[model samples]
Target: MDELSALAARVWGELAQAVSTRGHPWRTATLATVSPEGLPDARTVVLREWDEREQTLVFFTDARSPKVQHLQHLQHQAQAVLVLWHPGLGWQLRMTVRTEVTFEGLAVTSRWARLKMSPAAQDYLSPLAPGESLQGLSPAGASRPHFAVVHARVLALDWLSLNPEGHRRARLCPPERAAWLQP
Candidate 1:
């Protein structure tokens, strides 16, 4: 395998280890994407889950959010980068992954529901459209409700990370294409 690919595998393994030991990445990562006009937009969000087995990463956002729209349109040609900073290790894990949007599976949805969270998390999922600006006191304040239309489905993913170390940079290469480097 090429040096670049080998380094990537090493860095990816490090990140997978960190994710397993820590429930989430250090903080939310900045997810970057390009618009059809070639403009790039990025936002910081929590990494809800990561599936190293499937080479899959997961996050949640409002279905009507612009980022979700951009991801849906760019799924074919786009790549995503997840930067996980670790001060203890003095190393960061830069993961580059191919982007794919999907709804949470029964397992994932159940996990979300089961997490111990503030009341707002549940109310935020009310039937209201996700991305719209609220006019005033949203019904969100009046009632707590569980929704199926929650289109909680904006569950999209971006793929990719880079390792600056000589043997750590990785791309969104195929899963079986992984090779180990001497980092």
Candidate 2:
């Protein structure tokens, strides 16, 4: 492989390791999207899956969530960003991605089946959609069709490593572009 390919592979490898490592804060990334009003919305979401070959990342959410609507509005302009910071490791990854929402079909069905069997499935069982105010906590409900899986196709990966001596930063854009940048 060429130099840029190797660098991209290494960056992806690090991200894959971070997501797979239990208790690592990197497992949770801040997902940022643009609201219909042109406002920015961000929330912490769990990293569900990472495919290095496809250069994609996955996250789960309720289809009725506001973010889902934001994604729909994006459509062809479905650009989003995911930021991951690991204080212990002193590494930060800011990823530019094209987002795709999957509510039905094979991918969603398989994920829903697996999630339904896991304790985390409770998140998708909410009677009221996300951001709704409640008088009290509602009992866990059964899994519903609102469960969705979001796939993000990586467009660019900007990695920053903090160090006492000197910090390092690198940018990797798909198909064969990568370079170190001034930190």
Candidate 3:
């Protein structure tokens, strides 16, 4: 393989390894999006799927959440960042991505079906939308169609490895382009 392809492979291999390893904090990433007013908003989300070939990452979220609104408004820009930090490995990955929100479709239906069999289904069953004040606890109900899937097409990936011996950083761009950066 070419140098850039090798770099991308190595970086993606590390990420996949991190996800596969148990108790790895990198399994969750902080997704940062911009609001309609050009304000930045961030929240923690579980890493659901990673497509190496397409350079895309997936995460599930509530459709009614503020982040969804932010994503909708920023869809034209399609610019967002996902940050993953592994303290044990001392590695940080910053991915700049183009965001796409899918609320209704075969993909959403299929994922929702699989989620229904697990406890995660409860997350979509809430009667009240996210960030709403409630007078009392609400009982869980059937899964709502509001469960959404977010696909982030990675535009650039910056990997920072903070080793005790020495720190290393690299930037990877699409179509086999990579460069080492001073950390």
Which candidate has the highest lDDT of all?
Answer: 2
TM-score of each: 0.58, 0.90, 0.89
**Candidate 3 — which pairs collide?**
none
The C-alpha local distance difference test score for the whole of candidate 3 amounts to: 0.82
Candidate 2: tens digits of C-alpha lDDT, residues 1-183 = 876567677767777876678777778999999999999999998987899888889989998999998888969888889999979868888999999999899999998888787888877888888998876867766446579999999998888889998898888865556888898
Q: What is the C-alpha RMSD of each candidate to the true structure, in Å?
A: 6.3, 2.1, 2.2
Please give the distance, in angstroms, between residue 55's alpha carbon in candidate 1 and its true position after superposition.
2.1
Per-candidate local distance difference test: 0.51, 0.85, 0.82
Candidate 3, residues 25-127, lDDT tens digits: the string is 7778999988899888999988777788888888899888998888888557878899999787787889999889899989799888888778887777787
Candidate 3 Cα errors over 4 Å, as ranges: 1-7, 17-22, 136-143
Score candidate 1 by lDDT: 0.51
Residues 35-154, model 1: lDDT tens digits: 667688877755655555565656666555666666667666546555566555555545555665545567446745754275536534655555455666455332432322111111
Which segments of candidate 1 are over 4 A away from where they belong?
1-27, 104-108, 116-135, 141-183
Best by TM-score: 2
Preferred candidate (TM-score higher): 2 or 3: 2
